[model samples]
Target chain A: MGLKIIVLAKQVPDTRNVGKDAMKADGTVNRAALAAIFNPEDLNALEQALRLKDRYPGSEITILTMGPGRAADIIREGLYRGADKGYLLTDRAFAGSDTLATSYAIACAIRKIKHFDLIVAGRQAIDGDTAQVGPQVAEKLNLPQITYAETVKSAEGGKITVVRRLERGVETVEAPLPCVITVNASAPDCRPRNAKRVMKFKHAKTVTESQAQSEDYIDLTNDRPYLNIEEWSVNDIETDMKWLGLGGSPTKVKKIENVVFQAKESKRITNNEEELEAMIVELIENHTIG
Target chain B: MGNLFVICEIEEGKIADVSLELLTKGRSLANDLSCKLEAVVLGHQLKGIEKQVFPFGVDVLHLADSKDLEIYTTLPFTAVIVDLFKQEKPEICLLGATTLGRDLGPRISSALQSGLTADCTSLEIGDHEDKKAGKTYKNLLYQIRPAFGGNIVATIINPDCRPQMATVREGVMKMEVYNENHKGKVKTIDVDKLLKPEDLVVKVIERHMEKSKVNIKNSSIIVAGGYGMGSREGFNQLFQLAEVLSAEVGASRAAVDAGYADHERQIGQTGVTVRPKLYIACGISGQIQHTAGMEESAMVIAINNDSNAPINKIADYVINGEVNDIVAKLIKLYKKNSK
Candidate 1:
């Protein structure tokens, strides 16, 4: 029998390529300035899932992401890369969520999806750099988790083996199926978007998105059910209001300050031998370096 | 029962440095809160582990020794810690943001429905008055960390959650012995009773913990490169300078991402924080992400072709020149002077 996989991805502000305009004058990040793209590491997680599907020819891969309506783009991107279906967990109740609250919402969605042999997610998202969601989801689901995974070696006979990359070394571990694995950047980069797959999923849209589009687009989705990406809100999932949004979040932001460095008085010196020697001599004399 | 806790990690049968660092920080926090500082060590053959942590001013040491925990596994370790916290009701819990802590901290925080902040740069006791809620929270643990790709700093607090949890990177805090003669009480945890068979679902087949070849955090001097290093071959000049200065080699996150240097050598907000006495930055533009880790260095020197590089702002001495040429000169002058 083929395996069932759930890949968790996020659409994040491109923090890696932040330019001067990325920060506004008030010292806050200008969200409008940064381009939102599929989080780099999440793509690595998707690649691992794709690899597993390749190994198990009959396996099906589903992409699940929780964000704003625009996050539907992540689902279409996944579809263009080879995922069979996708779910967009979009709701205002998910706003102001810390890692734990975010994990709770994602876990509730996973329960709704029900059957899955494995779950894969990036070790961390660049926007938050908190590698908490994968393991927290596992805890909420009461399943084992293998984090910092560099490669998913094999999945067969209800068991999965993964190579984990740690700070100083690597370890290979085995866990029974229906577990979570957080992929690290060391894993292979994801394959680029397939031309045929892109053409096939180009029109995929969520209900919220189709409502804003022309009637023809709605008709297209009705005719081709595959083109209608699943969108879920607070009402769609079994959730407690207390655990849905900012109220359920245990952590709160007390303050945020824009990074500003105090400029020190630096002594300028040329690259000439005389100036270089003088600087080196001063450093050695002061015991700064010897 | 309400106390401060530091979850210690074991490396090669000894307490890890990050854990010791947290204990040092925990001792001060405990003193400020007028509470005891407790520590927990869950591993196999943990005999006499208390002797290692007591010097850091830990008031109580909880030990859970079992063969199943000889090597760190997620489920069993999480089970033991979660079970203990339910009974202790710690006011604040700190863990080293190592591979082990990052994996276990979230699980524990989620299970207990508590707040957890990861990779905190600073932790302090502070108060918060929520005008909207018409309430005041006294002595909340402020979890301060660089966010927004290191373009900003955020202070996080878990006012309502029990045992406000936070994780700090390995070298962000100093590990100082509170008192060599300090002593603490020992509490033994019943690991078998707490751990269920389901906790043993994941099995470790093989683990190779290599002794870290680069000791940058403890090094007094560091020669670091950045994206401007151009290629892996360009990094060789940094190694040469490091060898001459008897210093360790480090790299910016950009260099590591470019595959010019190893990830372990990355020095930035996302990597190892360092406070070396002398930091020679070669070809580094000094983004906040990179400078956040090394800004605390006792002295800094910048050698970059761009005179306007942000690193030049923090450097004690700035030299505008090609990195390759300047590094060669520094090496020669240092060798001659030392000789």
Candidate 2:
């Protein structure tokens, strides 16, 4: 009675803590300046999947992420926490993918990893903030979706209940198995990496990573089959060439402009009683504030 | 019909303010394109919903009043709107970037293979020429939004897609009435014919949607804080200052993410946009994300220990001081001066 769960995750630039150098003078993102980490809400999604695995004994969690070869880091990170396995969906064809094309690629990968009772993903990535991929993936796969989920109330009798944290309030909803659920940040933070699991999975690497390693490392992976993280490309999944990349994307970026604020002629006020009182008096007289 | 369509959202049996704002925007966009402005509402007890939107200059109102459509499940609503868009072939489609609209908009776009831009800050009708393809698209909806963590503003377009789609957050567009006497035609949808049994798979077990207690959007004066506030305990001074000035408390997304303030009070690209008469920004460095929400304030006062804080660039008065000390001083000075 073990349920199979696939958690869709991403390695996104840490946009939340963007620095002055995070953007280039050319108005493009300076990706090298931003640290790439497992998307925050995706960790929330992982925590939900882990909780479900705890409730359903023997439930297996698979971390599926789409990015460059280095995205394997998040997969290993997932394994170090509690997931049983991971897959990296990487290819040149995925470059310049908007949410729709990204979801199409992920949905195709999910189909290849079929036989799952549930699919989980973060409500939105911090970088894009579109919050579109989860529902789009559900539509691409023709599955029911519950977005903004704060908690998984239960999963029993072939049905799952989730509490969604909406803008105004919360809602409790139930959908049958084999559906998509996108977790919100309001959900509990993911549990810390397990020491034992980390020791066991520290050497996990994708095929590309394995090729770059020493022969001794390759031998270790052969001895430990679980160390191999699956890597899939466009050829690995059945996909239409029309829906694979920038050409497949319906939306196009016509222009991008760096944010430059027009400086106002501001009056500088010292932090003293006299200046502060004088400013307050002027505001009161002008009716700007009482 | 190459009309401009707005998908209306309902709250407490009334048309939400965001929907009306979009209707106002749709009216103008439709006029620019010389096309009709249409609105779609799906919910129960929506008998007089047209009355709510007609003043916004909607030329046609499509209503699908059904018990199943009331609470807003994904599948059925998507079925109805996707079905409607296919038949009508709208030139542009807009929806409020709320929980309901974000949930439904992507599904419809994916089903129809159309482009959708989320959380747009501005929408304009313009022309685009693809230099490589030697093609020009006229009157395309420019979906402008702050991207890459609000570091840059991008203009998105759907050159080849039918029914260019975009979602704007509440308050991003102003809600204005086109005419008090404006009237529109109503067309009821046949939900039963569109929805299959599988569409009813998800069920709402319970729902508790309370009106937001904080009214920051309409507040004329806002005392906003940021991550520099240090902690929740540090925010008490801001609350006291807001009370003295008869202002509402707002926060930067950084402050909200730091757990120093509530999410409802967040002011940024991702949060509520406010244009208060006076904005007293304390301890905020003024990232574009935060500034995009409140930069439209009539007057601004920036108080931070860092004199070089980015917020000072936009402020009418810049005070170099600690947030707690400066806020306390402002509260005391304002109280004494008023008396």
> Which candidate number has the best TM-score?
2
- lDDT, residue A160, candidate 1: 96
Candidate 1, A1-290: lDDT as tens digits: 68899999999999888887998998888999999999988999999999999989999999999999999999999999999999999999999998988999999999999999999999999998989999999999999999999999999999999999999899999999999999999999999999999999999999988999999999999899999899999888888788868989999999999877799999999999999999989888988877
lDDT of 1 by residue, B186-290 (tens): 999999888889999899999998999989999999999998888899888899999988999999988998999999999987899999899989999998888
Interface RMSD of each: 1.3, 0.8
What are the chain A TM-scores of the candidates, in order? 0.97, 0.98
Among all windows of 10 consecutive residues in model 1 chain A, the one with the lowest summed lDDT is A236-245
Q: List, residue by residue over B1-339, the lDDT tens digit for candidate 2.
A: 399999999999899999999999999989999999999999998988898999999899999988899898999999999999989999999999999989999999999998999999999999999999999988999999999888889999999998899999888888899999999999999887788999999999899999998999999999999988888998868999999889999999999999998899999889989999999998899988899899999999999999878899999999998888888888888988999
TM-score of 1: 0.98
Docking tier of model 1: it is high
Each candidate's lDDT (Cα)? Answer: 0.93, 0.93
lDDT of 2 by residue, A62-109 (tens): 999999999999999999999999999999999989889999999999
